[model samples]
Target: MFVPFLIMLREGLEAALIVSLIASYLKRTQRGRWIGVMWIGVLLAAALCLGLGIFINETTGEFPQKEQELFEGIVAVIAVVILTWMVFLDAQSVAQRQSTTGAGSR
Candidate 1:
């Protein structure tokens, strides 16, 4: 559904931002040569994510109707927990950055 699509889009953007930040830091620190290694790591991570998604999809499709419903409910609860944790971490990061920039003093 559109909800899952939006969730995936947001997660993908978050991942892209994280990778860009790491690459920027490496470049700024004159570690440009390690960029290839970083790319390799990124590719491996993406592959692993894709593999996991496919595995889950296949496994869940084999479940009986009642079990499938239960599995989905569990997955939804876990997703909510993970999303809440991500929001908390983001807020903490923002707070830390603001404090370091003396924005909190104002």
Candidate 2:
């Protein structure tokens, strides 16, 4: 329960960060009027996602155990792959910075 909550919290924060950056860009470009429209779109998207999740949960109750397990396993594998990719990208960036700064010469 806590794990899902934390994951959702992180996802929400990431989305908010992106929205903030976009909003700032729009404001900087003097396109502030569209910010309201962008926010409405975001809200609509959130509602759609919520509805889809509820629909899936309500419908999946009748699915067989094997299929449900397979779905969970697939989700877990995808999550692991994405996280591994992020970690590798971060490590590569750090190595590149160190090399440029001559900190890795030693």
* Per-candidate local distance difference test: 0.75, 0.74
Count of clashes, each model = 0, 0
Q: Residue 48 in candidate 2 has what lDDT?
A: 99
Per-candidate Cα RMSD to the true structure, in Å, reads 5.7, 7.8
Q: Please give the lDDT score at residue 76 for candidate 1.
A: 71
Candidate 1 overall lDDT versus native: 0.75
Top TM-score model = 2
- Against the correct fold, how does model 2 do in TM-score? 0.57
Task: Summarize candidate 2's per-residue lDDT along 1-106 as a digit string, tens digits.
Answer: 9998997897777667567756765674568999999999999989999998899889874568898789778976876676566556555655776777777532
Against the hidden reference, what TM-scores do the models get?
0.55, 0.57
Model 1 TM-score (2 dp)? 0.55
